[model samples]
Every structure is written in structure tokens, then in C-alpha cells.
Target: MDEYFERRKRMVERLKDELKISEKVAKAMLEVPRHLFVPPHMRREAYNDYPLPIGYGQTISAPHMVAIMCDLLDLKEGERVLEVGTGSGYHAAVVSRIVGEEGLVVTVERIPELAETAKKIYESLCYDNIKVVVGDGSVGYEELAPYDKIYVTASAPKIPVKLLAQLKNGGRMVIPVGDFVQHLYVVDKDEYGRVKKRSWGAVRFVPLIGEEGFED
Candidate 1:
């Protein structure tokens, strides 16, 4: 446990320097027990700063990518955040830590099995504010519309129009768009309802599967 803690510290340092993440995001990364979110067989590699398979054909994003997306979302306390993929629940845990008690994190997983696994993890982590639901993430969770921040862990053909509608004015969403090659895109909706987008270079992620995403 001590060694994992040390490795997490070092990983955060590297992420701050390499990914240019803020101090707050770095702290959240260190605080989340990443090992708990990884498979027991792969726990030793939990803090390696690389993506690890979590079964069900899904993989957690590398730490660098996680930090970059979190930075792009610019989450604030008490803000509602919608995560398009729960995976191992690590990213949602990190977001939960940042959101604290007041804020809510609604994470949707397409696989029933993964959603069940994530629900248990959330209970163990005592993330009462986080909700793990089994559904089509590409369509966006409408029950809790108007999210302050939205993040899609998988790559899509294009930003889902449904998701954009879910974002509150002045909110932001981070998603990777493309087929063979993907580019990380940061989209922001302004106070006046105007949207601006910027690319954060190439990235690779599992194709987001659903009506708005690529055919699985």
C-alpha cells in the first residue's frame, strides 16, 4: 500500500509536468485509491500511468489522458457532472472526490455487468453522491439534464448532439472525435449560448457504442 501511494505521488508529479494539470486535479489523482479500481490481477500496475483492461472490452484511460480531460472540464464544487462511461469507476471516483458531497456525479455505463460492478465500488468508496446507471451513454442521461460538465471516455464519430443539448450554457464537454484516428476536443458553451471548440491533439479510445456513436 505504501509503495502504491508513493508511485501515485510520482505519477501525479509526472502528470503535472507532462500534462500541465492544475494542482487541485493533481491532488485528486493522488487521493483516489487507483489500486482499488483496477483488477486484483493488475493491481501492481495500477499507478503505471497507462490504461489497463477492466474486462468487458473496456479499458480505463491512461492517467495522462484522465488528467487532461479533468483539466479540460475544469470541474468546480457543487457542479453536476455527467460521465459517459464508468469503466472501472476510477475516473468517476476521482470526479467524486473533486465534487465532494454537494455536487452530483451521474455516470452511465452501457453494460449491465459493468454498471453493477461500479455500483458496488461506489458503495465501498462511500460515494453517495455518485449514481451508476446502466444505459446508452452516447445518448446522454436525460433524467439529469443540464450538466455543468460532461466527459465521454470513448471516441466517437462526432460530438453527440444529444450530449451537447445536455450541457448547461457556459458548461464544457471533453470528447475524442474520429474513426481511424481521433483528436481530443474540448467544447464549451458560452453564457450567450455560443459554442467554441478546440482540439487537444490526437488520442485513442474505445469507440463509443450507441445510436450517436460508432457501431460496435
Candidate 2:
């Protein structure tokens, strides 16, 4: 336990120096025990700054990427967030820490196995503010529409219009768009419901498979 804590501390420090992530994001990342989200065999590498395969061809994003996305969204306490891929649920756990008890994280995953595992992890860690649902994430979880912030962990050929419609006015979404190559984009909806987009930089992510996304 102490070893994992020390590794996590070092990982966060490196992320802060290298990416210049915000204090809030760093704090959230530091508080989440990433090892709990990984497969038992890969727990030793959980804090390393790289993606790791969880299962079903899905991956848990690197810690730096998680920090970058959270910083871009400008997550705040009491704001609800929608995460479009639950993978290992590490990202959601970190976001839950930042959002606090007053806020909520509604994360959607396509695979039931991953969702169940993530749900169990959240319950075990007492991350009660997070809700995991199994569904097609590309269409966005509309049962609770208009979130304060949204993010997609996979790459899409284009910005899924369904997701854009679910962004509350003044909300922000960070997603990666492309086919063979992808770039991270920050999409914001203004108070008047006007949408604007800008690219953050190139990034590679597994393809998002579903309606409004690449066909499986």
C-alpha cells in the first residue's frame, strides 16, 4: 500500500512538471488509487505515464492524458460530468474526487464486463458519486442530458452530434477525432447555445464504435 502511494505521488509530480496540469486535477489524480482499477498483474505499472490494456481491446488512458482532459474541461465541485468510456474507471474515479459529493459522474461503457468491474471498484472505494451504465457511449447517455462537462476517451471520425446536443449551455467537452490519426479537440457551448471547437493537438485513441461513430 505504501509503495503504491509513493509511486502515485511520483507520477503526479512528473505530470505536474511535464504537462503543467492544474492543481485541482493533480489533487484529484493523487487521491484516486489507480492500482485498484487495473488488472492484478498490471498494478505495478498503474502509475506509469502510459496507457494499459484493461480488456476487450480497451485501454485505460495515461495519467497525463487524464490530467489534460480534466484540466481542459475545467472541472469544478458540484458540477455534473459525463464520461463516454469507463474502461477501468480510473478516469471517472479521479473526476469524482474533483467533483466532490455534491457533483456526479455518469460514465457509460459498452462492455458489461468492464462496467460491472468498474461499478464494483467504485463501490469498494466509496466513490458513490459515480454511476456506471452499459450502453453505446457515442450517442451520449440522454436519460440525464445536459451535463456541465463531457469527455470521450476514444477516437471518432467526427464529432458526434448527439454528444454535442447533450452539452449544457456553457458546458465543455474534450474528444479526439480522426481515423488513422487523431487530434484532441475542445468543444464549448456558449450561454446562447452556440458551439465552437478548437484542436488541442494530435493524440491517438482506440476507435469509438457505435451509432454516430465508427460501425462495429
Candidate 3:
């Protein structure tokens, strides 16, 4: 237990020194127990700044990557957030902590097994504010439309309009777009539905598989 706390502290420092991370993101990183999300064998390496495979070819994104994405999303308490992928539920857990009890996080996972596993982890952590669903995340979850922030965890060939449509006015979305390679794009939607897009940098993620993404 104390070891996990130490690892969390180390991770927070890594985010601050290595990346231009926001304070809220750093706080979230420190609060969530990342070791619980990774497999037992990988717990010792959970704090490392690198992506680790969970299972089913999916991976929890690097800690710094998660921080950057969270910072770019600009999450606020009471905001409605949507996560396109729930790999190991680690990213969602971090978001859950930042959003507080008022905010709600709806994460979609295409793999049923992974979704179930994530749900158990969420329950164990008492993250009642986050809802885990099994579906094609590339299509986005329409039932919970007009999200204040949207994060696509996987790499897509293009930004799925369905997700953009789901973003609230003046909302922001951070997604990695590309095929063999990917670049993180920060998209903002204005009140008039005008979208402003900018690329953060190159990134590599598992392919987002679904109707709006790569062919499964």
C-alpha cells in the first residue's frame, strides 16, 4: 500500500518535470491507484512513462500521454466526459478523480471482457460516477450526447463526426488521428458549431475499430 503511494508520487513528479502538465491533471494522477489497473505482474512497472499491454491487444496509454490528453481536454468539475476507449480503466480512473463526484464519465469499450474487467475495478475503487459500457467507441455513445469533453484513446484514420456531433458547444476533444502512424489533434467546437483543430504531436495507439474507424 505504501509502495503504491510512493509510485503515485513519482508518477506525479514525472508528469510535472517531463511534460507541461496542468495541476489538475497532476492531482488526478496522484489520486488514482494505477497499480490496481495493471495486471499483478506489471504492478511494479505501472509508474513507468510507457504504455503497457493489459490484454486482448489493448494497452493502457503512457502516464504522460494520459496527462497531456487530460490537460488538453480541460476537464471541469460537473462536466460530462466521454472516453472512447476504456483500456484497463486506468485513464478513466484518473479522469474520474479529477471530475469529482459531480462530474460523470461515460467510457465505451468494444471488448466485452475488458469492459467487464474495468467495471469491476471501478466498483472496487468506488468510482460510482463513471459508467462503463460495451460498444464500438469509434461511433461514440449517442445516448449520452453533448459531452463537455471527449477523448478518443485509440488512433483513427480521421475524426469521427459522430463524436464531434456529441461534443457540446464550446467543448473540446483530444484524439489521435492517422493510420499506420497517428498525430494527436485537439479539436474545439464553438457555439456556432465552428471547429478549430490543432495537432499536438505524433502519437501511436491501437487502431480504433468500428464503423467510423478502421475495419475490424
Q: Top model by TM-score, which number?
A: 2
Give the lowest summed-lDDT range of ten residues in model 1.
16-25
Q: Which tens-of-lDDT digit does each residue in 1-216 have in candidate 2? A: 599999999999999999899999989988999999999999999999999999899999999999999999899999999999899999999999999999999999999999999999999989999999999999999998889999999999899999999999999999999998899999999999999999999999999999978998
lDDT of 3 at 6: 94
> TM-scores of the models, in the given order?
0.96, 0.98, 0.98
Comparing 2 and 3 on lDDT, the stronger one: 2
Candidate 2 regions off by >4 Å? Answer: none
lDDT measured at residue 163 in model 2 versus the true structure, 0 to 100: 95
- Candidate 1 lDDT by residue in tens digits, 145-207: 999999999999999999999999999999999989999999999998789999999999999
Q: What is the lDDT of every predicted structure here?
A: 0.91, 0.94, 0.92
Q: Which candidate is the best by lDDT?
A: 2
Please estimate how well model 3 matches the true structure, expressed as its whole-model Cα lDDT.
0.92
Candidate 2: residue pairs that collide: none
| Model 3: lowest-lDDT 10 consecutive positions | 11-20
The TM-score obtained by model 3 is 0.98
